[model samples]
Target: MKTTAIGYSENLPAAHPEALLSREVPVPEPGPRDLLVEVEAVSVNPVDVKLRAGAPADGFRVLGFDAAGTVRAVGAEATLFAPGDEVFYAGSIGRPGTNQRLHLVDERIVGRKPTALSFADAAALPLTAITAWEALFDRLRLEEDSAGTLLVIGATGGVGSVMLQLAEALLPDVAVIATASDDARAARMRELGAEHVVNHREDLVAQVLEIAPEGVDRLFTAHSEGQIERYAEIVRPFGHVVAIDDGPRDVSPLKGRSISWHWELMFTRPLLETPDMIEQHRLLDAVADLVDRGRIRSTAATVLGPISPAALREAHELVERGRTVGKVVVHGWEEAIDSARESTDIY
Candidate 1:
């Protein structure tokens, strides 16, 4: 059988109208410990833009990571889920992504979809939620009940939106100070439980210091272009800092203050095939529970209609601009079942 998909054969900027293309690809069969998912909804992320810009020129690169779908088949060794189970996951960077109608993902990296959310809403959580959960609890080693100040830079973006709520729910005693340049974004962050909101366009140090004179105890940076060094100055001695974006950086300043810099990539475990790969499954399950219990909400702010090349390209453009407040999702295949069956299929 085959499935409809949107992908690219060449690395073109999102500015090009042909950057993404709609095609039909063979439905991938599950490997041991994998699940064949009939994708229901998918969300765009910054990583999707980055990967598409550098996609290989030979084979098409399907560029989606966050997906919510139902299990259609399971690998011989897969025991976590069976056919018809609703699941969500951030697929590995090593495989064909979740942009297709049928996707095969390791069961170890998949979790039960949130009961309270539609597939589109559940689709928005995996990548950002896993990134935030690992960045705070694993990389920063923040205690669940600890009392300290956490300054989240770029606090209204997809990851930041979920991070704010997770920090508030998991670290109840900690003061959450989020940075948003505009009043609307600031208000959104506050609504997500940020105790304080500061303008990132202004002097970050001054704004943070005004709230916590002693300096923030931890820093989670979702956007750090030329401001990495500033984190060293504003973070308290021995404080931890986690960054998700990739760029050339000078961390020499952090050493003098005894501050530690950590990098977080949600794909790390599956990309490396680590022994702890199953941790993603556990984390996603916990996040699903949180969402169901109303401890956290879906961060999907835009729904770009059905999964088609045109819709996906529009979503890509929005993400590439770096101005979207929350996650953007696309639901279901655009083509009718008969049309999809008649389309050319690439193996």
Candidate 2:
């Protein structure tokens, strides 16, 4: 029951990262429908930082959700994965999580990693990709034939990047619009297949109006509450707007346009113990196939450190700043050293 883990003992925000540190703890065993993963790589998300600082100063809180690794053990009821299989998952919000050498994850929420990507790159995709995928395909109900002006707000960040690519690959006929204020970031969005890129700093409605000359059919918001309603202006009547952030705000204005509002929390199924938790497994498998087929590439923007608490805290800080262009990953020390050894002499 003993294992090596990384977590925080005190409550601290990303800005004050010393609060998170590595610790040795008891390893968790897989329960029915769970798999014990020997974690190879993990990624940091803004939620990790928020929960760390916001949560009560209880015992150690393990906060990572995105991970790639090998299965070391499987619960009696687990049939999807077996020992020695390479897997990746965005673990449930309710679980102890993947910021450790070993973790217990529901087998139904995991999938095989893309054989093409590195553990670090693969680690970066799960949480954000799943969030974007479910929001567009599941919540918005965007069909393969759902062609329209699709606008992605905050489109250069991790989730946005993957969402842009997913839209491009699956909905090829749909015109994609992305918001990015910076020149470099806007160019990146275009490279990822956004048909148009606009400045989030300026008037979003005007820019979108100019581009569409009509109205947007779908809007995916990753930024402010103000932006969500602003997007409502650009969406055609009865168009859909989906957001992953569930901050309290008024959506009254959207009602006038009959614009449907949706909230996507990739963790909802696992957190609520939904009967559809297995859907995450299916979605992840689908994404892995896309990755393998080169329809989507890893959006790993940075690699922080081997799985040390100090490194994770730093990664959280970077994410909190709202500046990282893509995903950030950290490897277990063994995997980190091994990666260095195997890489070409490029550094």
lDDT of 1 by residue, 1-347 (tens): 77887889888888688898878788887899999999999999988988888857467778899999999999999999999999999999888889989999999999999999999999999999999999998898888778989999988888889999998889999999999988988888999999999998899899999998988999998777777678877999888889998843688778888988899998889999999999999999999999989999999989877788888989999999888889999987765444666774531
TM per model? 0.95, 0.94
Query: Model 1 — which ten-residue stretch has the worst lDDT?
Result: 338-347
Candidate 1 all-Cα RMSD: 4.2
Q: What is the C-alpha RMSD of each candidate to the true structure, in Å?
A: 4.2, 2.9
Q: Which stretches of candidate 1 lie over 4 Å from their true place?
A: 336-347
lDDT for each candidate structure = 0.89, 0.86
How does model 1 fare in lDDT? 0.89
| lDDT digits (tens) for residues 6-71 of candidate 2 | 777787666665677777888886799999998989998888877887876468888889999999
Clashing pairs in 2: 1-27
Name the runs in model 2 displaced over 4 angstroms: 13-17, 334-347
Worst 10 residues of 2 by lDDT: 223-232
For each of the candidates, give the backbone clash count: 0, 1
